[model samples]
Target chain A: MYSTTYHRPATVDEAVALFAKGSDAKYLAGGHTLLPVMKQRLAAPSDVIDIARIPTLIGIEASSETLTIKAATTYFDILSSADVKRTIPAIAHLTSVLGDPAVRYRGTIGGSVATNDPTADYPAAVLALNATVKTNRREIPADAFFQGLFTTALENDEIITAIAFPIPEKAGYAKMRNPASRFALTAVFVAKLKSGEIRVTATGASQDGVMRVPVIEQALAANWSAAALEGITISEEGLMADIHGTSDYRANLIKVMAQRAVAAAG
Target chain B: MANVQLTVNGKAVSADVEDRTLLVQLLRDHLGLTGTHVGCDTSQCGACIVHIDGRAVKSCTTLVGQVDGANITTIEGISKGDELHPMQAAFRDNHGLQCGYCTPGMIMSAIDIVNRYGADLDEDTVRHELEGNICRCTGYHNIVKSVLDAASRMKLSIAAE
Candidate 1:
């Protein structure tokens, strides 16, 4: 790794100040993803402001209506949390499936979401559940949060503090992992609307990050069945064609996995 | 290099290390607790797994300064010198190691698993939890069995206490 000045700030203000002091300064959450990339020479920040120590950035509060997770909340905390399992087991299950115990123990949901890896599972859940991402500057809706690959609504100096998701009537997430990194080659998140509108968000297969599969949603809205996604053609017009899966294979998986997700949700 | 102080293995340690100093480096070079192996240069391998404030974490990826006030327990801290930890004993009894490169991480992670899930864990759960740590040796069959055995033993031990 290239040399960089490391600052372990106790408060967000101090962290942000440190961040503002340097052009290439980055907030280090769990460092599960950031450190690896830096070590691999994929990214070399001039400074790293450690945010794990800020108490304001640490919390996992669940109420009767919604669950709010602070950015510093580790993936293992989500998986081991009783409130998460009771309210949104799918999110907890998402953490359980990410990497292994060591990574989950060190990786935070906020890091995964902010990194916005197309293959990561949290973004799919965020969009499907209509979660709100609270940055230092603004609360961004999931609809407007993800822009494209390795992109989000977050600005250069903006710091994310928390993410909130409303308790849905029912939801499920499923993915066909790449087997090597265990990242999704194709994943689908299905959420049931009390008004009978089904929202289907597709990840890992999208060329522009994650996109809603309108046809699958429309078919599910018309007929809530595994067969609803059968004839619905999910196009891979600009989807990512990776070594693990061709664009066509991913496009087909969008349909099959959406069907499986709908079935799983049901 | 910056002056730093932290609690490692339940003792206060102070050192003058560079800003680029990683926790693994602090443990190995400064403190001389070299049991935590650095298997993968990246964070993929859990060969550097250790407990920071009682949570399992990859020391290799974490900066030593981040763990200033945290309680850290490594593989060297697990056993009581003469007597092996139940997980270590289980790994030994079950032939859970061959090259033994990943043993420390596997054992550390297994201890964390048993602490969280108890002894009733199924085979699939063990496999799922061990995903972060890679082992080219032993095919993970014996490692999984070792974890299951350790889980049982630790559960009893925790219950007895």
Candidate 2:
């Protein structure tokens, strides 16, 4: 929202070049997240590089082993994509319930993942599915991608090009949505990987950001059923608490949503 | 400053705007089309909703530079001469509005719902899809009824065409 030059680049190289020229620059994808922050004066970059129109970052490619999503692909595209539905229906379902319809039409996957909002939906999926985030500079695995709330492994000028999600043997997601913003109050994503590993992650609950629920992962690994998680309890420590929910409540939600996710995965 | 060219409401219009100018500013301020209201400057309320390239998007959240070459359709452009669009007509007949502050956006989003889900939309689908457009007057009952009515009417018109 501040006075800044806007550059619409045709390619990743051009975008990077534009970024290098500006005193401060941010890659503009969907603008759902960046524009709002800028409008509020929380951020004022000298230049905005519009990478949403770049042809290389605009489609979904689903293969037997992986589901490759271009960075600028919108949430609506993911929800409506037959390929996404066929390969990772849990992700499609998550996309459907993200923001409202209008938000879905413009908000991009890369934007969400890059912003790395702890309450965002994509981080849980990316982490649980063991995805690889491909950026202009390098590829970062989901494990190393998210650092904390509103933080990622991305450098200041690194532009995410695409995300590669390895097809899971089974995966499902469930979340308790904050009614006003539709952000997750507490959400869980459970995945059974092709390598016989089970990854369970909970978002919007931890102050440290999206984290692996080792208890749920171990339980699902053994029995692979909701019943296996019957007696498990998540500790209230390190969980986030606010007016919406207490740490105890979120810890409880972590257990319940993880069970639901596992059941849905089946 | 930026040079923005858009096909707004079917009119090819060009404007010299600030780089930070929102699309809603272009319609309401630059073009004098005030039907697209900005209820909440943030993206929470859908009063600024409009069809950009035939998809419903929040105009306030969208920058003019972001949609330089796009086709935009706001509430004022939906009608033909004095005739109301079926969605607008349905809202009137069903009493879908109270203060009518959210009517334009509601009508725009409703048309998008019908376009995506088709004429066979049920009550739950209409209610769920209406999540973006909030009617502060608490008139969603009539709004839902209006969307269903419009879907049926639009179906008949499509068949007739």
Q: Tell me the spans in candidate 1 whose CA falls farther than 4 Å from its real position.
A: B156-161
Q: What DockQ score does model 2 reach against the true complex?
A: 0.81
Please list all clashing residue pairs in model 2, or write none if there are none.
none
Summarize candidate 1's per-residue lDDT along A1-266 as a digit string, tens digits. 77888888888778888888987998898897888888888888989888875788887899987889998888878887898989887787677667777777777888888989888888998898888999888899999999999899898777889999888777878889866577888999988755555788988988788888888878877888888677888777988886787999999998888878777777
Question: Which has the greatest lDDT?
Answer: 2
Q: Local distance difference test, per candidate?
A: 0.84, 0.93
Candidate 2 chain B, poorest ten consecutive residues by summed lDDT: B127-136
Q: After best superposition, candidate 2 residue A213: deviation in angstroms?
A: 0.9
Candidates' TM-scores?
0.94, 0.98
Candidate 2 structure quality by residue, lDDT tens digits, B29-133: 999999999997778789999999999999999989989999999999999999999999999999999999999999999999999999989999998888888
Each model's total of backbone clashes: 2, 0
TM-score of chain A of each: 0.96, 0.98
Error of model 2, residue A86, in angstroms? 0.9
Report the lDDT tens digits of candidate 2 across residue range A157-238: 8999999999999999999998767899999999999999999999999998899899888888889998899999899999
DockQ of each: 0.72, 0.81
